[model samples]
Target: MSYVPYSVYQPLTKNEVTLLRKKQFEKWEHYFLNPIQIGQKHTEFTEVRDVILQSWNRSKEYQDLNPMIEGSVKNISDEELKEIRKKNEVFHLAEPVLKQAGQELSDENHVLLFCDSDGIIIDNYGNHSVSRNIGNSVNANNGAQWSERWAGTNAIGTSIILKQPIQIFSSEHFSYNCHEWVCSSAPILDPLTNELLGVINLSTTANSFHYLSMMKTIGLVNQIERILFHNYYQVREMMQNIYIEAISKWKNQIVILCNSKGKILKINNDTQINEITSLMSVTVENNECTTKKEWEDEVTLHGSQYRAIHKKIFWYDRFIGFISILEKKSRLSHSTTIHNHFAKYSFQSLIGNSEEFKRTIHLAQVAASSDSNVLITGDSGTGKELVANAIHQASNRFDHPFIALNCAAIPKDLLPSELFGYVAGAFTGANPKGSIGKFELANKGTLFLDELGDMPLELQVQLLRVIQEQEIIRIGDKIRTPIDVRVIAATNKNLVEEIQMGKFRKDLYYRLNVIQIELPSLRRRSEDIPLLAEYFVQKLSVKKHHGPHHITAEAMGILKNYSWPGNIRELENVVEYAVNFSANGIITPESLPMHFHNQQTLPINSVSINPVKQAELDWIIQALKRSQMNVTDAAKELKMSRSTLYRKLKKMGYDMKSLK
Candidate 1:
């Protein structure tokens, strides 16, 4: 009786204990009923919690001097209540979180409840027969509003009155009916509106009462608020980022827009830029301007000062955010936008330190610095387009458009028109005005022609001419327009073989193959298997509803030994599938796809390794083992440089550095 609920395990002092006993007697006597003495009784019980005491007072008034109350009112019906549940999203949104929280508590019989703002228990999870404890006769369905005037001095009703979290332990219930139960309840308020929406609760038998239950319930309510906040902003943030990216190229000044909620909606760039941070504003805007205004004074950024502008952006005649443009505010924009036209991937995204991969990246880097036509060759799923994206982003043309066209994906006849724009009346389906071809669209950018080997011979001649002449002519219009585009072509088939077979033009192949980058198969870089698998797991985990995931060591070993015929793309898909099926936060062989169980065996002849290749593998394996399988350290141990070691690894199919 002397203990304050959820007080972090502190013992009450002698004076507090003495005070509690006197208050408890007065409160009990008041609830026990003596109408004329009730007011005097409540005034003397100074130790009682204001919320709890107030709730009891309201309950007594509602009971109309009745000393005992047995049940809750069932005003809402099964059907009508079901409709209410459908109307409320909090009931559904809190279900998964409730389930997780209920499971986290060690007590199997603990129950979690979600109630509407009116205190109607809408959803209950955890421990079977959760409603039976409160008596099944009370329409123990989505029924019963625990208002102070209804259910009296209990967790839910008192919490509603206090507008804060509270706990009611055994024998504390004003209703003689629920005295056997102990419950913790926290009010869930709308973060945006700050209005009471509902209450989340944890309940169990008297003996199972937990002091931290109130804390846990409060934590869950906070979490639900955060999830709601993020859910509303996720799409808005993505849109803001897209807009920022589009304006980054043109806006060399500072422009920021924040929402009504004071959250950063979007900005041209990050915080005050590096160069702009050094300068103090010469003149600050003191007068509040309700409308758009031109900056009369300037602020210095990077040793230069420029004018600033202020504008308010509104939607539907309501203020949403601000758009402030600062000129000569040295530094960069806060947009944090990845320009759509720019490459989506780069060397940083390649994700492999294997020698073969490094050499390929090196070649791609060298080719990126030039304006030459580059050819990237690899089997399907070997990340050909990845290399192209990397080169495009690193090249001087990175800020410009990076248009990709799949020669094989497009219809053969349409390929010509698609590559070289068609004019009005050029063909039946051609646009009336005119169409700009990929060549024109990528005039100052890079044109990624995927599956170039699959291009028809006739079209190849025109493509070859475009590359040679730096110009293109529309099908209907005979006017030749000059183009200055960088071409990066990718092929899965052997171009040389296609030329010999007369399916591909030899001259076009030569023209497109100015600098070649050949990607290695996954099987050839077997040591990179674990690395890729872990990366895929972490990347794919974000898409899961559960927490972070991990793969068992045995599962990883099995993955590394298997031949990945479909290459890196296939590896990603396999990881995704395994993650989807994994259980208990860990992926085991049992969680893997059936194909993993049926790993194919290599033929005896193909399994044979030459002495040099064997030696290379042994040394690399030893070095990797010594460096804890780190490529950077292993390269240094072998007196090899980063890209140089990668090239060496590719030279002999795959080379291993020596640990010694």
Candidate 2:
């Protein structure tokens, strides 16, 4: 009587039962044929003579079926052996993601197979019955040689080979054994380039497989792609936003907006009235006057006291808005000095000229000149690392390596291994050889630790010891390594405050603060506006391989009066923006960004309101009209404190007496 393979189980699909039966038959055929080959080899070749001759009686059926095979058996050539090894190589790639997914698949009566590009099983998980039936280990340690050609064309190998998703079921499999298994596979793509990253598959015995399993795997792959896509986008966007905010926070008085239409849409704290009016006038011109849309130069309507520049903003596929640059009338001379100072540090490659920045760079250079540990404090996007790099390059150590690392970029658990070398076999799956940390790599050079505030306190202590002793002991080693290295640490957060909160070590703070450089926010420095614009315009033109470019005098003026919250980085960005958007030969107030336009709506078209100066004018005019041009009495009623009121009237360029 036929013996049951193992035990009774539930009924299975026709494909599933057929696959098991076919594989069983192939196994029986192999067993029955093996003894005959052994008998022939023993008769001619001496390698397995004793065992082969002993088993010859069991192979009578094989001898009757063949004639030439009865003489001798031949050895496989090196080339033939090489082909077997090559097939094994393809299965190794799927070992990791498969191992991680093993437990989950085993419980579900499912086997996850990592196949080579050829659909040969490289690895798998599940019970012996399933594993054997699936035929995963026949070729390698995985013991399976099932290929789409032998099993059937399927999602696992087909998707990876084609670099696209595919599905194949029992009937679709090329081989009867694979017909019992159903598979769903998708191409894992690199988030950035949309290239095939790898292939992911979910499979089960035909009896256990369901359509839902296929759907679930596809959903998982999609989620991974979405996550990768979002992360890439956020990284870029965060950098830009941080730059803008850093400048804006410091330059509180200037409001810079990038809006549609090459119009100045807003202004910051500027005292000049006539200049504000002219800028407002330009905004009106951009909106109402079509007039061929040619860019206009710096226009002096009321006076030559103020200047403005216009630049357009473009992102992705469309032109988003314009950036209106505004600046003050006074401080032009000192502004020129600041501008030149900025030029010295300013990159024809970078844009930004601000007083605060000039001082910050000067301090950074000084810090760099010495080996003293420096603490660079500033808001995000204020170019803390840029400043650090500048210091490194300016110092005597410029010839040596200047390595910068973000202390907070790595996870806390891995920070130790990342910062200090780890001995070989320190942990499972670790490099067989020791791995050197960044600190060791930066030996005899400058190590710029960015985002130092984010380092965990535990790692901080270890780092502090390294800095103090000028040595490090690798994980899993007793030997101490002494090295000479200079450290430059920068952070956007206030470490002093962090210290008070018990988050940072005071000792480490002192070590890092040996020389401290606090960068000023962009808004504080109003004097360096013009040179910055010119620098950005020229730099961007060169980078774009475009115009011999210019930002008109008016544009320069607008830049000065406006607040810059994003600092030098923002200034550089705006310049790059203007340079990039320039279709005309020059960057005019109209070509400028709309956010730079310091204009607003009014009830009447004729009523030109310079908000900063207009408020004062309105007050003065009302006081004069009420007092019948009596200055002494009008000052009292207006509560102007006399001299102050007189000064205000003079500044407003209005005579109450004339109104009377």
Candidate 3:
């Protein structure tokens, strides 16, 4: 008897090999049946391949497998098998490759089997009759459990135990049920984790065995792994891009990119690296962070609060890693604090009768009927916030909180905490008692985000996520608090231009702009100026403890003719100033603002000039005032190039130096 290496297939003919395997089987049976002589008798089986002999010993001794069994004892239901295949996402990736291999081997009476790491056949493809025969004889069909413990020494089961490729021929199989089959199987492993993902096996009748079968199995395994690795790297590259984009967009904040395992890959320069890592470790340990595609929560590290926004990166259906943005939670000072959480106005409070203003009010009334987000766009002081409040007051959730936050007023570093809130002791300067974020406070109600265009790009990403998920996580807290907030974001700047300039996220813009209500500027709705001025005069006179005041026809004409650059807000201020100066409780042109008095002689209402030119002159004058007579600054305020502003000023017969 001579020992043969299993690695190199012996060149013996079918008949000779059959006889040799028969002899090995007889020896195996004799050794297993006579347990008392097993140790000594195993040495006598030198003609058998050492690998096969070892498997036989494990099957009979360790597994206590009965070689006389007709087929594999363990099997799963069809539904269970389907779930296993579904859960092993890599199996789907290997299916096409395996089907191709099956096609190539169709004429060879071979069936290709894809099994999970547990050796349960998930799928099989090949000659239908051959597969039927194997299934009937050895129960090697889909869902059959082929682990060594269940199916004895066989290719699929033994390859799993060895974590390598193996060839099991007739009679070499420890179970009598598999004696007529030959199988070549190799394990497929995850490239990153190196964990056995599954096994690929080629099985056929022993009489049809070919030396190239094991080679083909190994090749298919290699090919499948290549696809897996390619997908893995592609996902890695995508996640890297996300990380880089996040770092670039959030340069001032702490950004950490991590693998699915929560290991950090890239992180911006920050002094809180260890604290962040520790926080991540806790999240992973508790199994709290990996499930969702996008989630946010607060974490406390070293007594300081941080908001950890987790955005899972995926390539198609496979999760690769995630980007974790850590924004520090800081308490806003008293001046910027938001105290009111109730709508102060209703549809009736919005006083205007011009068609343009009426149209805006109409749209807001429609917006109030639904829970959709609203974006109120207009120039400064166009009553965008007033419309937002009216919408909230008119909605069904009117009884709930109407929290408002002006994004531009709050410091960038403190905005997240203001919007999302922080836990007690979330940061060094944070209030020890912690405060509720606007999102949480406005739960089941409306959140008016004023100056939405001024929201930082990084905060915009979180805001979009919150809108989509309808949830918020307070700073320094791992638990996510669900919210039902109808957001009404108001912006004075054109978000479309801001988006093109990369200062605003287009997705966030769309999220907020689901129901856009663009209010007409005061200049466009000049017809409403007299009515607005009269309304403000009466309201201010009561506050001043005086008799109801009247804007004289002269003053009313001046108000309607002037372009109200600050819109309704400016009109209210003018009326308030007039009320203070009116000796007879009559708001006359003489009591108007000094600038308005100076521009009184300008042909602002001259019938010869078009209303467009009159409005342009008013805008220029207003910008100059706002910019404190600096032509360059006024040009920026007017959103025109300096040279363009100079040309317009010169054409309008205005001396730039005199204005300065």
Candidate 4:
């Protein structure tokens, strides 16, 4: 009989078919004497053996081409095994198989085998009777070595070794003692790539294996394979549908699906039909319009300024169809409340209310009133972004989009495409459907570029061009699309210094610095601590879902004295820590962080201005002065320990050398 290829739709390589056959025959020959083995007659086993051996030989010749390690033994770690189970989801998918197999194989005589990636039997059928024999042997879970070489030939290992199917009878089993049952196994192929997913086997205490039993096992394997294949295909289809929907909804683009012959299968009518109808009327009325080839973006919509960009679609490198998207020069005007544009976010959402904060907000509002580019300068964590957001809200474009992007967050190589948008498939891993960048999204609105100092020099030049020309050409495309986005840039580094260091473009800085807002650190606004602390307590309580917000006067005093290096962010953290850990209704000095509470020695908090303390200090100073500023003598006169007096003086910012 002529042998058919293993997989009908997508045939496996001859080498693969050979290997699978060889493994099947080897296991078949070794298990022939066993009652469980399927092929009983010597003649039948011999033919099966020859066929498998020939397949295996041919499979080995192409061993180098196999992506999987052939015949390699792996000591699977627990974590690795768990990962494999997660990827395979065998337990999840095996329920239906078990149900079907249970009906076919009698409950009293059946064994369902679960193996590791290497086919080492880790579990068996839930039945106690069939499981008893599998528990204590070297071939069982604890002692089993899942390799064809270790067992000299077995269904599980050889099926995996050759990536094929096999059945071993009771006596044909290589192990000397265990030949009471037959085992049938098949390689579970991955639905997507048709790789060897794993092996599924059924063992039972039955007579010599028959074609009927082997066929049942193969049927179970196919069922499981179908489930896996369907899952992958369904997930991919769902994701594609989601992408198509998102593009239509958010971007208002059109999507067309067509057959290879270019007949339209589907058309997502995301664009305005009235506009398309007008275009058709114009083409029909003007005979000149029918014969002339027009650039996609140049194709006016029914004599309207709006144009359509034509893009092709492909799936698996097959041309699906073409899509025409009507491109509007500006965003649609909406009749919603202007406040709703920033309903979820606003200047009030900013974390602080310090004098410095008020000053920053005022300047931001001033900058926003004008269309001039605004540059915000500050140290890291000084609320530069808050200022930017505030400015966006204050601008004439407040009702329009307000998009923020961190220049430093994007990789240098991809920053250009990330900022300026890109043509579809401009480079490897580029979005096939293309994407609109933040700048385009912010057209007729404000673009807040955070950490602008970190932008690459090449991208800086491109950005400058956009700012000056009021247009952008996507990467890999030359059509200059007009844009109208107000640029609001912020940086922690000084652009002058950056320019001197050759890290920032001086010309770009000049353009961006048309209006500037500088944010001051929290330490400079220590006077606002009491009010800010109260605000923080309320905000933190609400955010943390805690109740009965209160802060002791002592804690507020401690907060006011600390020089916050991390600025408002650090202050928020301290308040949050107090709110989370403090059990009392009021957060006290004791409730403050250990570092802040113990920093009583810091001069900012010490009572250095008191006259009594000063008199005592002065008397001690006089005594030390008379004793040639000897701290020991001074301590004796003050009747305190030398260390105590020294600490007091240091806390008071009194230099011992100056006292001497």
Candidate 5:
């Protein structure tokens, strides 16, 4: 014997079905007429479905809906509905499916309604006669708001609330105006995010209600979801290809692919997959990862710290995932070295128009085209690091890291470790998990070494060897690791003079001096002072969160005439000071720093010397006083090559030995 499949509803004769619907209709009518009588006890409407009964109660109590309303009262304007349709992806993608369903049900007295997640009908297709008949009473047309609160107990609104498929029979509708129609609706959700995109509703006349309608609606929804998933898969495949290319470009770094929710999807460096996954897991568990488009943070795993940078990936304006790159943290904690590992300035951002400054920029550009080591020479605050950053940004390795280290900033003992990383337990105070050095971190990129003249002689030998061999041995390890770093050394002290003084390695100097760029002091390039001042005024004003104050002609003259010994750095400080004190948004003479006012008087013999020469003389005198007339200490203080300082002193007829 053949077995019958189980069913939720027992088989009922046509006559019985008619009788049940009649009872349901009567209960709905009675509840509509005297809702207070039925409010006290739900048992009064025993014939009504529980879901529909609850909806009816909510429509009356919470929504205060009137069953006697003529038609949908919350219909959006045509222009508004058009805009909604334009932004909705599912509406466009499900067009073909919706059209097919509409055609199939055209002669069956049915209409297909497409509603957004908010249950506002965005589109309708099917038999015009059926649509017109139902729309006349309930306004079940395009742009009609069908949410439960607005239209009452409909399939689209109820399914939206439940996030599931639902069928509302004729009398089950809360509003009397909708009692003549039936609707089957299922939500269309994003396959990747599981977010409700919209709903597909199949509607028909009350007498034409069929149980199979619900199944058809669900099938249509499934088809739409499949299309969405297929599109998503294509985008994901494209993203994978992009990541693979990035992996090749960034071979040594750890690259990760994550979904919008911060879940790891793929990783480039499989050898460190376990460690990377552990780090990501800890980050996610601690809620450190967020939905921001781009961010960087430090994460620790296995007792080792790493800097993870996340950048969101988008396809067709839809957020797909994130491309994350991880770098092993170094021992240095200075803001310049630790946080800013990438070049932030380009050649265009370097502000200068004077012939002298322009010549320096042209040389720097030429140096950027080559792979030779660069030596930038200038006084303090001459923007040597800025030039270094611009060169790195304009170089072929711009996509890679641009690591900067100040040779004078770090202590002599710790300098070696900061240059070449050590393994765990390499030293008494070393991190247990080891740390990466600037050389390793800067592999395949440029390393800017500031204050190169201050490097200890012993370390200079190691630096020269590393440059020659293109490799480095960690402080505590004997194994030499290959590296591909383009060294760009900068200093206010002349390296040639340091070599003469037996303080610098001659070979290292030759290695680094392959390309030389000397930035001019502010006094020498006084023609560009106004431009620089204006640029700083605009830049610093924004930080102060006020008007972009302008410098008065008199104030600008004061800035131009005053000798800037501190160069561009000093100029920026002065501008920032003016911005802070410029109470009326206009920088005047009074807004200038006090030092500028003090330099108004000049000695009799100084009148013959130009402002630039006088500024240099003043700096030399200050440095001599600060160093107790010692040439070496004075050279260090002046940031001038010691040999060069002696020549200047001799030209000025100042014998240091006689002064002492």
Candidate 6:
């Protein structure tokens, strides 16, 4: 089954649906309460899951009334404990996946529980603060035996027994102590064999039932299984490749070849290779091939037993024929052959001379010089991403990958796998061989996390942890892979305001804001408009294969004076539009978008761009209002003495007091 993302679960789940469900829960509760008076025969609760009914029956059979919060467990010998742990080694793969998921539901007063195949909790945590409040009823701490017999029909125990995913809420939990909590659980299984391994359970307060709880738990279970499957496939592929390479190297010496099924597919140089019909036949017809020197075997065919060495592989845990290693041997390995992604922009490419713009670029360069996390903030089209690319290109990590992902573009459920990656069989619908995540791809380089304010708070916690530890655990994999990635996060939204609104995490904000670079909006740096537009025009000419073009003074005035709400990005689009509309290499007012001439929101219904004259003229008018015609106070407000303000205005041919 596919996962139900929060978008569908949280919003579409209405108050009416919850109220309807509460009514149904009351029906099941009534039936369970009147067990002695009610007959089991022909008695059924409509809309109630059979599994839940079975759990209730099991609890009734055991005469377990008012079951305690914590279940009793028999002490095992060290050897037994070790064997149990070893058998449950696969359970560790679910730790990170569950940890991230638990934190996702932390605000909902939830906790995550992981149990071995026997339903004994090996690990448990979530919102520890909420967990503490639930007291003994909730805290199913490590080593708690929660099998159906011990825990008495709980989600974890019931899941293990049923070998399927299940959800139990409040009074539905067969035990009285667990009535305050809602638990949704999915069984973890062997990726290759689908054998029941354990269960991944999410426990939350019944009063605070989250709509996505069951869906998320099931999704996580699928993810963990996919990881196991992925890892197993990788191992088989790796061994097959190694075996094929070894045999090919000794092809001339032993003149032998075999296919994946151990049958002699081909042979060379009249060597008696066909005598070994199959790997197992070789082992059977000859002496038992032990003391396993890889690819070496004693085989007998045609009644002649000879010591033959050919690559042999394994399937499951059984030794089998050599699997095909079809890939050609290459001089370049993954590390060297892997493509190094390039950043499109460098500091020199940031075309702006405005003081505010220049200061931002300089700060970006400084941020690049040091390997600190950077937060680039500005309006959507104000070149925050370009600044990020420039910083990456300028940094020591330039030679490595410059991975970029827009947080807003990816779905919330898929973000975890895309960021950290997963092992094969980590979940259903996952690749059989697994896939690499951005964190791994950006190792030793820079990862540009754009639209970071849009990142869900659940993921922010994990992101903060990765930043602090400089490490990540793949989904359904226990190994902690270290990464040296410089994070450059960009956002159009104000992160400080987001943190105040509780949409962003304070700790993560501080971590990512180590080197903050706030780019100026295009409106704030109006003088740079011409320079930026000209650059875009020139750049677009070559791309569009249009002739070199010059914008007329009238068109430039419109471009400069009209306030650019969409910033540099919008300006670039406008330039492209103008180039296509322009003819004879000259762009006039006719080439500008219709809105410029529409004058609906134009400042003063006229378009004029004169940097020095316009600035002095505006100041003369503004200073007059602030000073009420007093030149001295106006000069002070301008941070200049009275004579300097008057002289500066007069140099540009402005009569300051008379104009005021």
Instruction: Give lDDT per model, in order.
Output: 0.69, 0.57, 0.78, 0.62, 0.78, 0.70
TM-score of 5: 0.44
Superposition-based RMSD of candidate 3 using all C-alpha atoms, in angstroms: 25.3
Full ranking by lDDT: 3, 5, 6, 1, 4, 2
Per-residue CA lDDT of candidate 3, range 1-660, in tens? Answer: 112235336466778767766776787666667663333434567666777767776776654458788667889999998888777767877888988988887877899999999999998888888899999999998999999889888898888988888888777787787878878899999888889999999888877777788888999999999998987775565566566667755545678877767788888854778877876666556654446567788888678787777776644344556677777677312223333466877898788787778888999999999999999998899888889989999999888888888999999999999999999989989998999898988988999999999998988899999999999888898989898999999988989999999999998988888999998767666667777887776555323323435678998877766656677888888889988887556678898888887663423332344679768987887666544466775675577898998887677767677565
Runs in model 5 with CA error above 4 Å? 1-340, 603-660
Q: What is the C-alpha lDDT profile of model 1 across 4-35, one tens digit per residue?
A: 35332444454654454444545656655555
Q: Write the per-residue lDDT of candidate 5 for residues 441-503, one digit (tens) a residue.
A: 999999999999999999998899999999998877889899999999999997778778898
**Positional deviation of residue 450's Cα in model 6 after best superposition, in angstroms:** 0.4
Q: Which is better, 1 or 3, measured by TM-score?
A: 1
Clashes per model (N, Cα, C within 3 A):
10, 58, 3, 18, 0, 15
TM-score pick, better of 1 and 6:
1
- Cα-based lDDT at residue 333, candidate 1: 39
In angstroms, the error of model 5 at 20 is 87
Q: Write model 2 residue lDDT over 53-92, tens digit each, in one string.
A: 2222232433332311211122234554455435432223
lDDT of 4 by residue, 1-660 (tens): 212222212334546544544554465445433333232345535544443444333333442322122222334566665655554455456666766666555455666665654676544554556666654433444224445544434567767766767766443444433454556778788876678766777765533233345566678788888887775554344334433543434344444333324344445672555555455334334432232322354455445555554344332222333334554444335433332223133576565566667777777777877889999987787777777777777767877888888999999998888778999978899889988777887888888899999998888888999999999999888898999989989988888999999999989999999998888656555666677777777655333322345787778877876767677778878888887677644687777778886653312224446887787666566556434456775576467998888888876667676554
Regions of candidate 3 where Cα sits further than 4 Å from its true position:
1-12, 36-41, 61-64, 269-271, 285-291, 331-660
TM-score per candidate, in order?
Answer: 0.56, 0.39, 0.49, 0.42, 0.44, 0.43
**Model 6 over residues 37-75: C-alpha lDDT tens digits?**
322543456444566666666766664443443533323
**Candidate order, TM-score descending:** 1, 3, 5, 6, 4, 2
Give me the candidate number with maximum TM-score: 1
Enumerate residue pairs that collide in model 1. Answer: 268-333, 268-334, 268-335, 269-333, 269-334, 269-335, 270-334, 301-330, 355-646, 620-656
